[model samples]
Target: MSMAQRERQQLVEAMTAAGPEAPTLCGAWTVRDLAAHLVVRERRPDASPGIMLKPFAGYLDGVQTKTARKPFPELLEEVRTGPPWWSPLRPVDAIVNLTEMFVHHEDIRRGTPGWEPRELPAADENALWSFARRMGRRAYRRSPVTVVLATPDGKRAVVHSKPSGEVILTGKPSELLLHAFGRDEVRLETTGDPESVRAVLSLDRSV
Candidate 1:
């Protein structure tokens, strides 16, 4: 299966194993709340603008809250079955949902005790790296100094370039993606001038 499909299936399975009440790393969201978010994001496009636009957030929250009130089984079924036939996301699932699924899967997996990082296939790591590179600027846009993404083996990309200085964040592709997405559970090394590193670290990189 494609990485996106694999991750989506795995996320559903993880959600099933964890049950509705399980906590996720997504702030105060429970597994049920995350499920409702996934459902509303794909199925309720009219409300999805709130995901990135603050003005629509209240409307989006209203829709998501209502969706969460559905029976947990039905909510999960929607997430497992994928988007509806007419939804635009159906045709671009891999391009769009890969990171969304992977990160949220980790959110659930790592939020619980006894979790460990998975050894992902090299191709999956490459995919995450590509996505991270593309997202570099937007992810680190608020940083006061230049931000650099580096893999353990030395692959590097500049996120926010500044003449002043840069902070290098080193980790595996998956870990870098996690950190870029504002997840604190990832294992990564931040290096650079101490002052610049602190500035980068203090910046919120969440979507």
Candidate 2:
């Protein structure tokens, strides 16, 4: 299997083992919801399953098969087959799909005990951070926050406004990433009126 495929397998295994009560990064979803989310791909020929999944269409225009009693191997096979039957989605459609698959998989693992997915290469982690950062541009402008990250691990992330200087925010990259992604700690971490950090978070935390 390719590295991506291997990673995909790990993702499936993690979700399957997650059972019902496991916590996912998406506070709204349980591990089971995440498994279901992973299994059901979309039928968008133009867009990949990740794109469809990202908007959380899984709950919106979603369908669940009566596979409750089915073996996990069978359930995973259904996901492997792709979902022209459910909706239109392109497989490996874009970076968004890969990133979603990567991040949410981590969410599932983060929620569960003894289910840690691989630590992810620093390069890979940085890449995802970079992607999110790039996508974060326009949204950050509207908010009044600037964020900078400093870490004991020597990893840092700096997100700030360019001209307006409304909000200034910074912290560890991972912390910043987590905060950007709807972490409760982030909300409690409001530093100043430059609530723009939270504003940026509110706007872009969807993924």
Candidate 3:
């Protein structure tokens, strides 16, 4: 199966196991809320802009709240079924949902008790590393210092650069992906000039 498909199934399983009330790393969103958000993102194009733009946020919030009120089984089913035929996501599921599913899966896993990192296939690791490289630039685009993402396996990318100094974030591809998605519950090492390190840490790295 494709990476996106694999992660989607795993995300559905994780959500099912955790139940509706289970907490996630997405601020105050529970499993129910996260599932609703995913459903709306794929099925409700009108409110989907609210996910990224501020003016549409209220509409998105209202949609998500209403979706969340559905029976948990129904909501979970939508997430598992993938986007509808007419939805734009149907054609780009592999590209768009790959990171989306993986990060959210980790959100559920890390937010719950007794969690540990999973052993990912080499291909999946390479895909995640590419995602980190691409999204990391956007996350640190305005940083005052140069930023580098490095993995123990020697794969590295200079996502952001500045003349001031450098800050390097080192971790596995999966952990770096989590960090790029504004998640704090990741295993990573930050090493660089003191001021530069602090600056990068203080920045909001969420996607």
Evaluated with lDDT, which candidate comes out highest?
3
Query: What are the per-model numbers of colliding residue pairs?
Result: 0, 18, 0
Better of 1 and 2 by lDDT: 1
* Model 1 per-residue lDDT at 151: 95
RMSD of 1: 1.1
After superposition, the stretches of candidate 3 with alpha carbons farther than 4 Å from their true spots are none
My TM-score estimates for the predictions, one after another, are 0.96, 0.59, 0.97
Model 1 steric clash pairs? none
Residues 128-168 of candidate 1 have per-residue lDDT tens digits of 99988877778899888888899977799988888888789
| Candidate 3 clashing pairs, residues 3+ apart or interchain | none
lDDT of 3 by residue, 1-207 (tens): 799999999999999999999999999999999999999999999999999999999999999999999999999899999999999889999999999999999999999778889999988999999999988989888789999999999998999989988999999999988888788788899988788888888889865
Residue 157, candidate 3: how far off, in angstroms? 0.6
Candidate 2 lDDT by residue in tens digits, 82-134:
44444533454344355555556567666654543355567555655665455
Worst 10 residues of 1 by lDDT: 198-207
What lDDT is obtained when candidate 3 is compared to the true structure?
0.92
Q: Which regions of candidate 1 are displaced past 4 Å? A: none
Better of 2 and 3 by TM-score: 3
Ranking by lDDT: 3, 1, 2
